[model samples]
Target: MPDAGHPAAGAAGGSVPHRPARLPLVLLRSPWFIGLTVVTLACIVAVFTGPLGRPLDVALNLVLAALDLATAANAFSTARHFPSRPVRRLALGVGLIATIYLISDLTEAVGTATGLLASQETLANVTIVGSNLVLLGLLLRYPTGARSRSDRLTFWLDAGSVLVGAGVITWCLMLGPRREGWSLEHLATALGTAVLLAMVAFAVVRLMLSKRPPLARAPTIWAVGSTFVLYASSLVHASPELLLRIGLADDLASSFLMMVALWTHRVQLRLDPDILRRRRRKPFSALPYLAMAAMFVVVVFVVPEGLGMRSISALGGLAVISLLVVLRQLLAFAGNAQLLRRLDRTLVDLRAHQHRLRALLDHAYDITLTVDPRGRMSYLSPAVERTLGVPPAALRGSRWRTPLHPQDARNLMRAVPALLAAAGTTVTWQVRARSTDGTWRWLEVVCTNLLHEPAVCGVVCNARDVTESRDLHDRLRFQAFHDPLTGLANRMLFTERLIAALTEVPEKPVSVLLLDLDGFKEINDVWGHHAGDTVLVTVASRLTAAVRDQDTVARLGGDEFGVLLVGTDRAEAERVTERLERQLEEPMALDPGPAEATVRVVAGASIGIATRDGECFPDPSPPVDAMLKAADAQMYRRKRLRRTGGGRQTGRG
Candidate 1:
């Protein structure tokens, strides 16, 4: 299933999945489209309307300002979507240029409407010129993906050329309205036109070789085209063919197209869900462009023109516009500074989050680690060094498997890829891992699928030491089935073996011998229980030694023992019983306890035997419990004979 929050489904449904689409095709029909339609209709109506009077001027300027502001909003919205810093810088730069255009247009309109300007080309025209140059400089760095130090160089060089060219042209072609004579105007125009022509040749050559094509070239090209349109609008009074109203309207249309085109990469670089609420920050360098425009205003209207005293009462209005531009620049800088401070706080909070993550890893069982797709360790907790006696740094990278026990490596390696692809599950297995001290340590390892998480885009593993517990469990198992004193199979173990033997085919004859020690209790009565314990231990040792290695010897109970003889006939069973009687007839020496004297007490064996030879019993053998009971009865009968000093004999099958 796809995550509902995602704009498009991913093959993995993870954070930071591939971009939603190559372009937001739906945007063409969205609310922005409708807004663009209304603005276009308004721009066409304003352009085609009647006269060049104050009311038409105010209405046209208001509509142009709205279009410029809408363009800024569009660029800013695109900036908000891009995660790249360079992309945001370029986007917001275009937006700032549009906003300055809005202010400059509104100022000129107001100055014209109030009859305050002697010429339409005032310091407000200077603002338009400077802002257009700024836009051209920023456009040189468009798309921001392919970059070099030369980008900054190209930006400054082209901007300087455009600014100088515009200033000279402004002074030469448009200064006839001012008191400055034709002498200044003719020289400035000729020199500036010649300089611009030379720079154009150089710019064409440079742009040819230095160009890095953008992924979305149309937007930036339109953006550069829009800057040229604004520049052409400023040259409106200088050129007789292009009218002011028509030039400004065309500039607004270009601006709108440029703004729409800026969203080209928005569909390539999708929004980060985590930063949805974060404000897109502007670059510090953006403030200076506005400052330079404000200074342009001050120079054209304040100092150079004697505070506009001769110019249609323009001093007060130009001062207010200049002040407003300066204030807007200052406020933008202040807001950007505040956003930088908030970013610093976010960095501090991120550090605190990392501290908490480390603490959790430290306290959890075992050492934690993350491994990349190639099975190389990417991250290892401090506990890794503490537990494995190897530095975490040493185990990182391609050396991740350096400490794996060779015997377990093949299986673990084979399972790793499948484990990582398991999505949201865990796999567990035990392996013998090599430690720094040259010993193999058993580890219980658990690996979880965390490949979907960007921070942990790999498998997370936790390995804990279980060597001590494993050893204790083995020892407990041994003690449960073996006799403590003799270290031989006890009654329970012997019974299980007997039952297993009965289940097998009776082709091979078998015999069970039940033996009671003759006069064994008398040794305890004379010497003490300590001496008797020593006697029983010695008898068990002799019993084990007397039989073939494959035969079973068990301590059934106090002073009684049982033996299983495989592949034995009636005659062979009798011979084995006689040999067991002779082996126990010898005397055994015992050390009773500390400081107690030695007592050499003698003991003999009374043995009973049961055989399954198919002659005495039916086709099938008797059950293990019934066979053992019959053997015990025969052993008591032998005990009577031993007490009466009768001859040694074995029971027939």
Candidate 2:
């Protein structure tokens, strides 16, 4: 939308989304228009009546003053409601100009009605000149779209040509012809009228030639029409052949046009300034050419009267006009050359930047995608195929979250609305994505909001694959708590489970069984360390098979192993011990190597059982160290009994 400070639509940050509303039709039926029309008809009737008597003339002047005063009041009141700064300033300037016109009309009326104000003609002319000067100032001070220094310079050159040519025409028409017995006052009046006409011409020309006009086309056209009428009226009033009453009628019509211009502007202010279309300007204005043609016509008419000082002056003015035109063309050519050079450099830099961006997007390990406000993928980089095993073209226009795990997709969809609500916010999240190979891969995605940016207008996502790292982390966690060789729980894991069972439910029956191979060391000495490893592997397998799936079996150290039985008492523990004993006793077949025959050997294990019982255990009732010590004592007692000829298969708890 156009900014309040600038009036030109589509200028820099001035793009609009809708067409500007037209002027209100009710203005045609407005009281100001009706009154002005009635006054115009009366002025025409009075002009055709041959003699405007003093009483009637004073009445008309007073009526015109009143009309001007009303216009000024309306302008001032409407200006207060305008939202645009430039529009408001223009409305206020119009009010001030109308107020000056009112003062001029009042001065003329007072002079006609009363003879006390002797210098009324001079005062009236001064006020009228002051008002034109104010209009000139307002036209020049109005803002235009931003332009280059060269463009502004060219505009001024063209303006200077028109102004210089108008000066020649003003001199030829108002002051060139000889006048016999002319008074100083008469000469002064003619000169003032000529200067005022030139000012009006310049104001109109400047408004038309503006690259970005402060007013819309309709209002500006009406304003230009008003000034042109004033210029024509001043010329007719200065001429000796035209009736003075006709000039007055033209003045009345010019005032009417100005009022219409103000009313149109008021209607414009009621609509959104952002939707108003500014007038487009031509590449080159023909106004200077028209001014030169007028000057030449004036010179042709004045030259045939004889070769005099005015003739020479008119020819010299034509030469100056020619020089200005040539200089303006040269400046335009130079400015074009400079613009072309700058454009070429900008194109070269843009191409180089694009090449570098393409290289980065193609080679980067991370996949980059742009998602529009509709949640569809607008762009995906070349790395998408390499990282996700999915082609970029297939995903374009599809939702980027389609391949994500169900929970992750839901979470991303929920967060997308918040991320889009604020511009430039960024979020990073990890999601599991199903690849073409039917394996779920981890992707760490960083999404940044750029919906406010005109060039981007989408959210940018950079995703990097992290599946290998995640798998390595899981393996490391498993190795921290389990034995690497036997794939069974280690001593640390067994102790942790025992402590958890004791603290979770204190009244629940829990027991630990400790076991030691009877002659495992002798087997390693006889068949090398390879045979000892084989025996340990076989014994671990049998122990795991003998217990329930919920029970935990661990390699304590060396040839010793441990088992934790939950919800079990002494009798249950003894039954498990007998099953473990039978499995270990039957596993005896072994092969030393391919070169040796198979040998049968019995690898028996001594077992001990300790149940958690507050009545049997000493001071530290259910502590982990106290329970482990009780089981160790029972295992040693059983080993001693077997060695001293007391045959015992299981130890008492």
Candidate 3:
């Protein structure tokens, strides 16, 4: 048998369960692993060019050529998979440019070493310019889906700036080899360089001002800006006098660009952890390190006079700084990864605890339910069957209105939609439910919305059967308002009747009759309290039969009783009182063969009347108490008159 906690196994009638897809281990590690390694190695090679000399230079060039080729191949492969035609074309353009650059670099290295086709060096520079222009155009033409018009314009401007930079490089290559005095190539190179610099400055300003997704833009601008500044400053350094000024700028720009590249690569890797982790292994960078070492060697061996020492020192410092920054970035990456892992573990533990708590709630006696904003049940606990005789499965996906009594359903349906609108609030109401057994049961329910929670994703209702308790409470309430011994309205109920009558029909003439059964205490003393109870029950029945149903007959303790008659005049009250007195005078029957010993009990009752204007009694202050007091006083006066030999008078004056 399978464990009850686990999802039920698929059988003839069981539901098939879905399993979550597992994340690949490699995907979780880093996103820019390949890109970062390539860029870092390239920077190292550039830095060490002065020390490593010919062999190291050749090796670094070969490495660069290989990386450029790989980048082109990868770009083409990715382009083939892209959904957008424009984006695919742009990607293909970038790949082609990269391929051209790779070939040029390889041929340039060969020509430099063998000294055979030295003319190709200038051609290689031209090829570099053409490739850069093509790459920039591709970057501009790359489709950014559904961007604003302004963004499209800005993208084009930025790409144009990069193309302008390529034009400057082309001009410089044409002029540097010719060295002709004041040539068009030389002037054009300076002008193009100035234009490119201005464009870069504008782009930087835009970057600072714009409030867009900074992740892609910030690093891209920083890398391009630093590269422009470094190359421009290097060109400005012609003689010893200009060298110091330009060399400082060159050093600052180079160092800044390297640092920026390192930081940007780290951010990209962190942002996309999956791509970095999928790599088989980190690429080697020994050639770049060797190239950097050789750059230092060349600086030491063949030192150019006038500010060469300062240039070498600056380059050395930049290389050291770049190395330190790379190490720092790596450490930070590792720390962030560790934190993410810890957080994931904590979340797993929390989910486990939540499951255990849910298990406990599922078995609880009280019916627990979860609903959506539409008031449809999202979840219903097992206790639904025990409490309402409704299965949990039957309740799920059903609207709450279905289970409610028809009379109550209309109001509940109206209220629930309004309640759902105020999500995260608690709403409570008493509802009559139609049980599975076809009986109506009252349930006190409290609903709370769980819409605020990302996981809970719905509203929850906690309900329990309160029918038995409510019925018991109502019974006790009824008993409080009636005399337990006689089953007649007690003082409390009588008072309520008198007040209601006084307020409702004050001008119509209400009579309050206070009755005392003569010799009732003597009868109780002669007989037991049980016999007295029997007599009281008999008296109650007689009073009920004598008075109109609208009139109230109450046991006001001992042998005293009270009645409230609505719309009765003083004459009518007198007639009613005379009849009640005559009926009591004739009654004397008891149980157990009492024809000879039958008690001769004569009972008499006194009555009092009061009338007021209906308008005056609109805000009647304790009207029942005032009426009862007036009746009591009059009843005493009549009793005194009878005791003093006053004849019974039936006429009302």
Best-fitting candidate, measured by TM-score? 2
For model 2, how does the per-residue alpha-carbon lDDT over 389-463 read when each residue is reduced to its tens digit? 889998998876777899998787666655655567788888999889998999989988776677987778999
Prediction 3 global C-alpha lDDT? 0.59
lDDT of 3 at 421: 51
Candidate that would win on lDDT:
2
- Residue-level lDDT of model 3, residues 289-353, one tens digit each, is 33334445434433343343334443553355345345544545665798799999999999999
Model 1 regions more than 4 Å off: 1-342, 359-365, 370-390, 393-421, 427-444, 451-454, 466-475, 496-513, 545-552, 563-586, 592-602, 607-624, 644-648
lDDT of each: 0.64, 0.76, 0.59
Deviation in Å, model 2, residue 118 alpha carbon? 5.7
Candidate 1 clash pair list? none
TM-scores, one per candidate: 0.43, 0.61, 0.47
User: How close to the true structure is residue 368 of candidate 3, measured as C-alpha lDDT?
Assistant: 86
lDDT of 1 by residue, 502-574 (tens): 6786677778899899887888888888778888888889888888998899988888899988777667888
**Which window of ten consecutive residues has the lowest lDDT sum in model 2?**
1-10
Q: Provide the global lDDT of candidate 1 against the true structure.
A: 0.64
* Model 2 spans with C-alpha error above 4 angstroms: 1-22, 25-51, 74-100, 114-123, 133-152, 169-195, 203-219, 237-242, 262-267, 270-322, 372-378, 389-415, 422-425, 434-438, 472-653
Question: Taking the candidates one at a time, how many backbone clashes does each contain?
Answer: 0, 0, 14
Q: For model 3, state the Cα shift of residue 354 in Å.
A: 4.2
